[model samples]
Target: MDNSQRKLGTPKLGKWELFAYGQLVVPMAVIGLPLAIYIPPFYSGTLGLDLGAVGVILMLARLSDVFVDPFIGRWSDRTHTRWGRRRPWVIVGVIIMMISAIMLFVPQGQVTNLYLLVWICAIYLGYTLIEIPYGAWGAEISDDYHERNRITGSRQIFLLIGLLIAITVPIVASQAGSGATAASAASRQAMAALGWLTAGLLPICLVILLRSVREPVKGHSVPISFAAGVRVAMRNGPLRMILATVILGALASSINAGVAVLFFEHVAQMGSSSSVLIFALFAAGVVGSPFWVSIGGRIGKHKGIGVAGFASLAAFALVPFIIYWVKPNYPGAVFPAMLVITLIQGFSIGAAPILGQSILADVVDLDTIRSGEQRTAFLFAFLAMVRKFFEAAGVGIALPVLSWIGFDPQSHANSAGANFALTAMYCLVPLALWIVSTTIIWNYPITHERQARLRAALDRRTARRARVRAAD
Candidate 1:
């Protein structure tokens, strides 16, 4: 359970072992999907916080990661504990996450924005501690491209399973008490249950992952200074492009998520059944992840992601048109079309994270060639900032736009312009970004052949270094 794990060296992860390692993502994903999709609305509808205030507070909390994540990543890299570099941070993170989850989510009385902000900050801090280190560990555990796809794909599948669980909570609450649209006491209690479930789940899974998996074999590392890490992180060409694709893709997805509930409530009018639609979308991602991994193996990861972006772009572009066409006698009909389009988009969802992480490992491999060290921790930390920034940015933008379009509490029966604003933000804006991300990712230089060559060269370098050490 401690640094004694470090001496076990790099062990080949078998299929069941991979499954156990991936199982750990479920707890974090359960926490994550709700944080992005549910918590803001939970605060606004149930707790009576203003939309803008919630947006700003959440944005600030996420923005703090721009500064905080690098240090956490660096600390994990340098950590030489018996529990291994990643496990200690993950353990501490789980405790903080549990405490914060209970305090922020299961409110007994009136709570202030300040209270919400403080707890949100704590939750995100713990989230960062776990996610950044854990991601680095995954990258370190493998060098084979197809094998990594299996690793990341397995983890992504678990993540989708968690999101599916989070998605069901609304339906459970709706049937138990007031219907889902109202955000009533039933819904609040359901969310409270979710928090406690996550609190219970994290420790169990943390124990499983630590006992099951071990880190990769690493040669001597000339510790990367923060300044040097920053320089390499910036100077690396593919990393920059990868970061760009990640940011833009996240921006698009986040924008769509920001207005999804509103679109369901005001425009589509799906009511409590909204969770079903959301669940379908995520379920598709679960089914599609392995397919994407296979496709990435066939093509390059970057090109595979481009195909996903194109598919997502087409899906989002069709959304408003479907809504527009279905608005009158067939307003309910739009939900089916939404499900189909989102199912198509789900292919992209599965591809993005799996390939993004896989490519980061590839990029880190190249960085190791140059710097003579494995720096997965800080490198992945940089990627995490891109994802966090866009997630916050998307929500931040959506809330203000709603206010500007005259969407207030009484305005669920929104004006034509307000409706127009919702559709445009929900569909077209994301569509545009999706196009850009696809274009950028399509030409990304790393290919399967190139990665093979890179690995071969690195092996030769390692053997030469070993020969030199033996002579000394």
Candidate 2:
């Protein structure tokens, strides 16, 4: 058994295929964006879940991702279906997303703390079924490093779009209902709409992937024990660095996301439309996302990522200073200042995933050389777990500190300490962490030249094997 034997088909990505791959963003965002942005705030403020309780539930829910991701990833890797290794799981994940999105909206009536925790656990588990497989599918679908970046960029863009749409839910619901208090009905309606919309878009995009990209077959299962497989992957230096940078970056970003609502609602006084403002920044990132990919292609992935992280650090570090300088000094100019910070961040945020995926592609190539197996999906699963754990730790630590700082959602503005916490989390802390992440990336060993060498060797081996088969 060899890589060639595992494939159902090999087709170049055509325009429609690209479109389909890009369309996956919708489902990804629909299913994922709300958990971070809307769910926490809604539970804490609207449903009367205590901030501390909300934080605990969120932390616990994210931790569940650690267990679920690898299991699903490993299963998806070994799965053989007429539809293909990735698509069947991709479809199943979407169906689960449709159901769970609805579950999230179902108001479990005045519940005990235990009941609420149980409901939250269910939601988190369902989300893992959707997210982990979906991410692995992205990695598995393309072997070309640049093509993978394009696919990932398209995915991230749609993800941003989904975030934009999700952000509008509160506003849309408010307008549909009489006011904020009764917007749950409106939200329910929105989720229903999103559910069907994602369900529809997913299959369509997958068709594009199915039709356009020919997956390399997992023709031969390595005889190595699974434990040995795990060991080989863990010991890979390039993969480890990529994982480290991603975990650190995810931690920093998750903490920033957890605190951003506070910054917008209280510090900036964006009011009920604060969600819109925050999402618009995300949308702006979606808009700017391609440039990052293009930059990576131009300068090389590692340098491109370094540049993007540097920009994010600068933008994040400037937020508080600009706010303080402009708020009383030039009241009307505050929005502009905030916009500047967000606009820059939008471009910078895309760097990690785009570069990370490219690096992962290289790791896949390397793994084949060292371990004599293509277990890209398995490695991605490992990443899925590491990413979830650190993200949990980030939100876990930040939320409790925020609660202790008296971050009452009902308060018109946070108390001075609460304000300090929000500002620091959103601005200062992330800026510092981004700097550290970039420094780690600077040490990344996979150069474009190295990738070229690996690919050339793989190609020659493939060609020689083909010639041997012909002679036989």
Candidate 3:
């Protein structure tokens, strides 16, 4: 069948296609979970590298993407092959990730700060290749507003599932060994397991996705230079608003992830149960995805994000109080209280990425109408860069700050001041950023009504182009 025929036949993606698309995220989460949560402490505490140096290395590695992301994005948009524009990059990314996962996750003899820096940079480069194109691919899958939610929502569910699996591996691996493993040893074991899991599942998932899902046909449009494309994207008001929220939300999430294990271990006195707690957190996110998506449909995408942000803010606000005050009064209540708080926070986690990307897809429509070019991947690349840069920044800033404050990850006898610093970094910083992000996005200009009007105008333009071509 021709491209138009295929597009007409599948106005909505089939379940199997969504399933295949979502599976790709599973391995990504497996790799990502440890990088954000486990790897910092593993390298610094277990391997005896300087904590501050490790943070700087990771942050610098992500900074490399400042040059890398936009290039990959523009390349993917311009690429044409029998396999497809996005898939070819995904193929290259899988190979890069597989090799780097083995090196970083399953380290060999004499690991050092330099070793950590090199391998981490390699892995992040691989991630950018896949993530930029993958996001653009999803945005192209369907034009309907709600269908965009379904596309992103499906990915969110699988992303959470992958996170659950990632955490479960370490919990099972640590428990399966001898009695009472040290935190550092447990983290090392977890990394090894995660390495194998990622290497094994990544290629298998890639094969399934490539075989099952077909890329959509590209419509005719005016081609623009990269410089011009960047200029046009800057002028897009909705894109700016959405990206502003993305920066804050992603920065908040990165801060929380960077220090979560440390805070739980040192502050909440829940080190041994860290994986279980995280598993519970992401599990709640899995269950809550559908509810948040429904809320987006009911109220509006931006408002739904606002509600989730408030829920997250409330949950984060309780952390310091629970650990510092409530624990002193009723020691037994801390874990239960923290568990409830974690669940509440995770439930709100699904809305940001799910609804945010949906909003971004609409913004892409607006840009298309104005610029007369389809630059979905390029725009998605900018979002990905912001997320990675800030995620790295969060770890980069948090770890060094903790070190400067004399908080030792290996020592149990951290001073009261050090413990309080960890708590504030984990809780208060994210809470403040979430408040800013929610405020910026709560009144986003693109609603369902506005998006429908944009789509109609594009449709009219497409029809006009067809008539002119026929006359010629």
Candidate 4:
């Protein structure tokens, strides 16, 4: 909004407060990255579970989140506590998450599919508990359009920091000829260290946020059944567009992540260099966060996200060329080429989600303005559900497809055909998903100007209610 018009109850969180709020996501990324990239390999590659079976188990377990996320969101909205709605859930979720983080990562065993399923479900459940409500909390914490962008971006920076830390472990271990070696003493020790770090950090981060960042007071959720809430959520038009964006983005991202270790290890032949490439990728994100926040401010977050999507596509376009041309002919240049590509891709990777999330706050505002109910948590929860569903589906398909294409990590040396399959899985699938995501978000309905209008109208109605109550 211009200087002439600032909406009431527009939150202005200071830098430190925003930092405090964003810090909680660090350990989350540390724990979560393994689930997506490392732990799957650890199980299928290290523990000797069949790839197809691991994929199925992972899908079913994480898929359980679709049910739990919305319920938790609904419960979060309905809760009334002196500590506040989201924080209570945060506390509970973090405790569950820390315990499960240890379970998922720290185990040394003759790994059973059942054991994997149980802990994966526990981690997903705990993650959902924190992530959905936590996301909703950020949505409600501020009303300013650009300020919300700043909040999401700031948090993303810290998320990248955690990622860099988490990813650095494997890179360094590999340099020492130890980590990501798969089913080795050094690998187990490296993973154990990561587990302990995650378990240790989850609570510390949550405690800082709980002590520092204040939750905006909210009344009980609109009295509606979960069924009705789903209907209401569906009826929100802009939200539907955003949901499509989330799913498509999730699909592209999950596929790339699920395939990353294998693709790098075999196709790109990155080997010990994989970890370094990952660290560089997220480091690029760290550098890109503010650039994206600026872009959001200038062209608006939707267009900004569109820009990011296109940028990501452009960067991804280089992947195949790098794999085919650089890796085969100029072997040493492969790592450097990938380093550049991932860093550039990371720039957009850094931007798209932060912008999408920032845009979601505005979209949620549109929902509140239309429905006359601030059902933030449920909407965020539903978005989380869609994302998880797609992520599970993508990984489920991607992993099995890898096996079908002869990705025999057991053999530790894939054939040329298998490497080609890895290239297609890594590059082509994600390229298609990114294009779809870009198209989905290209004409997003809510803009900054529009969001300001909605917020002002809501403020006027809120003032009217206060006056009526005082008169009574």
Highest lDDT against the true fold, candidate: 3
Instruction: Looking at model 1, report the run of 10 residues with the lowest lDDT sum.
Output: 1-10
lDDT of 2: 0.69
| Candidate 4: stretches off by over 4 Å | 1-8, 173-186, 219-222
**Which has the higher TM-score value, candidate number 2 or candidate number 4?**
4
Minimal lDDT window, size 10, model 3? 1-10
Question: lDDT ranking from best to worst?
Answer: 3, 4, 1, 2
Candidate 3, which segments miss by more than 4 Å at Cα?
1-5, 8-11, 181-186
lDDT of 4 by residue, 1-472 (tens): 3311323356666788789889999999887888888876788877778998888887898688787777888788877887778888888889899888888787856569988899889988888889988998888778899889989998899999998888876545544665345323226556677788888999789889887777776632236676766787789888888888888878888888887887777677666677777778898889989999999999988898888888778877988887777766888898788888888887777787688888888877777766667878888888888899999998898889888877886676678888788788788988898898898888987887888898888778777777877899
Give candidate 3's whole-model lDDT: 0.85
> Scored by Cα lDDT, where does model 4 land?
0.80
Task: Highest TM-score: give the candidate number.
Answer: 3
Query: lDDT of all the models against the reference?
Result: 0.79, 0.69, 0.85, 0.80
Write the residue-wise lDDT of candidate 1 on 372-418 in tens digits: 77778888887888788888898888877877777753356789888
Instruction: Pick out the ten consecutive residues of candidate 4 with the lowest summed lDDT.
Output: 1-10
lDDT of 1: 0.79
TM of each candidate vs. truth:
0.94, 0.88, 0.96, 0.94
lDDT of 2 by residue, 269-380 (tens): 6555455456657877887789978887778888888888787677777777766787768877777777777778776777777778767877888876777666666777
